[model samples]
Target chain A: MTTGNPGPTSGPVRSEFADDAEMTELVQMFVDELPERISQLNEAWNSADCQRLEHIAHQLKGASAGYGFSVVGEAAAQLEESVRQAEDNLSAATRQFDELVDLCRRATM
Target chain B: MQQQEQQPVLLLIDDSPSIHRLLGFKLKNEGLDFLAAFSGDEGLELAKSNQPSLILLDLNMPIMDGFETLHALKDDPETIEIPVIVLSGTTKPEEKVKAFELGAMDFVCKPFDIHELRVRINSAIRISRLMRMLELRAQIDGLTGLWNRAHFNERMGTELEAAQRGESEIALALCDLDKFKNLNDTFGHPAGDAVLQGFAAVLNAELRSYDIACRYGGEEFAIILPDTNLEQARSVCERVRVKISERVWPNYPKLSATASFGLTHIGADGRTDASAFVDAADTALYAAKEGGRNQVKVYSELPEAGDGPAKLALAS
Candidate 1:
């Protein structure tokens, strides 16, 4: 299971570790879950609800990092940041949120 | 739903899109199908329906993490035989230890190589197949595909014990081919093989599946009739003897043969020894051969030949 270069928005979360071929293919199974999770995160952001957004972001962060998509995890972290600081810079937070979602999509791909 | 009707399923629970995509692509060609669940609840539901052969679970998730899922899986009898492998981003020693303690067969850290993952999955499947095969081999005879001597011993003991306990009677019959050696010598090795095969088919068709027929040796056969007495045993032996005597060798049409049978019954006294039952039957068999090549002899009225030991003998 060769994990190629991480996209610009995502860092190499999975590349640091070396696993046998069996483990590698197992990691590759994550491809199926990405789209639905990304949609859920998007829904969480659309509502501008900090709690649900943070919940979704945290999930993506933990899972994407495990699957070697540090970029997606980083994007999730930023999205979580916007939710945590929701009381300030509402518009700016929304823009940052959009960028984070895009980052997640690119990172996973 | 019928328990017997359930189809075995394999569940793949992971949160990464790329992982699922690649796996679906790789596994699609292998003739196995899998259901994918990104969350624990979804995985649990799929497991309930699919009853998978194995589970590949991811540790990190939004709600109901892999830890909880593994517990639920192991705790459920329906899913217990389904082996699980943890696919997680947590490379921590404690995490791996915890996964195994929770009954995961293996743990693989994230960004796994496809080749290695395939090998592990295949290995797990192979192990399960081997275990099932071993269970089957225990009941099957290796040589003639008929029940073996050991099976006969077990069935006889059980039947006799059951009969003794219930105040019932049981019958035993032993059949030895008459002049079998001469047939082997005249027909050569291949002809001898054909005889055995042909005899087995005839015996199989003549007897019910519940009737135990064992290849006692080179050309001998044994049958144990539960709930049967000496009269019934003689009747069954006659039917079988008639079938065997009537068979015409396809290649050598003129060739004809017969088998001598020994019949004995365990009386209501329930004191008949297991070995004695066989001994009585064998003695009757010798009588059948001595009296006539094609005949069924009962042990109660017959005298035992001075056949050395009291044990059942294979008269060479």
Candidate 2:
């Protein structure tokens, strides 16, 4: 799959800043913090806290693009949208959350 | 009170630390004093105290959100003129309209294109700086560089209101160059202008930093001394009088000028009217001019009945 696409067999997704000399350190810091964000997402999902899930997704959607992870940002946006409209489609939100988690796992420095 | 221009301050009110970090890094070289607030409430407080030139406010904050914060900032007389730019994660048309209607100067969607954001910030700051320059020009006397009469009237009302609230003692003084017309006739108007400019310099030098000096009209000037009593005001005005009498005019080496002052104290009984207070000082000023033209006279010490000269001792 392409870098931003959610595919089970996709290779590691390199940040857009991974090649930039100036942004290397910042990009590495963002990459280092990914595990904690993933855990937070997992905790919010397992607790079935829709508000907490949407808040995290919203933050990630805004922050990921700045860190050069457009794929993660786009996934987060999709998850945020699904959760926002989850009154009748809880399954859709669940599917988006799972896709976002997979994208985060594949993200690289 | 003239303030020296400094680096423009940009306050960022956002809940996310990542946005602050990103913008802080991106805008590092933009010659801005950057301030960050994690929530809208904190941003409002900073805006009030620091008076930032521009504000970048996030619309998605919790509790006191961006809309509420913007409303509060615009509501306050102190922060109302500061320009605010709204930042949002989503570009909802209705939200954009709401933000603009609530007085936002611009709206940017996150994550920002750093270049575009920089241009927008520069343009906003430039416009604000130009506007402030224009405001200052409007209130300043063109010749003497002291505050103009209109600004003095406005400040007098404000100071009087503060005093009426029992906040502090305020003293007003009306100073006039002794025999200004004679000096103009003797050495020419240029020399008179030079003397007026020279007196303003002395006023600037003699008054405390908190004191405000204004060119009332012609060779007449007014001073507003906040948190000063009658004795304190007398000492300050005495110094101005002494300094002016001692100054030597450069081109016209033979010209020597002196000024007379009339002082009045207020807020002891919470008097609020501006004109009446001015009239009292004017009465004292008339006493100074009549009592041989080179002295400081207090309004309270003036004779109770007629327009006779005040019996207060001259400054030694």
Measured against the true structure, the TM-scores of the candidates, in listed sequence, are 0.55, 0.88
Q: Which ten residues in a row have the lowest lDDT in candidate 1 chain B?
A: B307-316
lDDT agreement of model 1 with the native: 0.72
**Residues B1-316, candidate 1, lDDT per residue (tens digit)?**
0025233355799765555765776666555667899889889888888777779998876678899999998899887777898987647899999999999989887656657777788777778657756755675555556666777777778877888788776788898888888987887767776777777777788876557787777788888877776677778889989998898888877667788898877655545657877887888888888897688987766644434233332121
Q: Mark the 10 consecutive residues where model 2 chain B has the least summed lDDT.
A: B307-316
- Candidate 2 Cα outliers beyond 4 Å, as residue runs: A1-9, B270-272, B304-316
* Tens digits of per-residue lDDT for model 2, B1-316: 4678788899999998878888888899998999999998899899999999999999987788899999999899999889898998898999999999999989999877889889999988888888888998999998889999999999999988887676677899999999999999999999999999999999888999989999999999999998898899999999999999999887999999999999987645545468877887888899899999999998888875134232221110
The per-model lDDT (C-alpha) reads 0.72, 0.87
DockQ of 1: 0.14
Task: Report the TM-score of candidate 2, chain A only.
Answer: 0.88
After superposing the true interface residues, what Cα RMSD does each candidate give? 5.9, 1.0
DockQ computed for model 2 against the true two-chain complex using alpha carbons: 0.65
CA displacement after TM-score superposition, residue B22 of candidate 2 (Å): 1.5
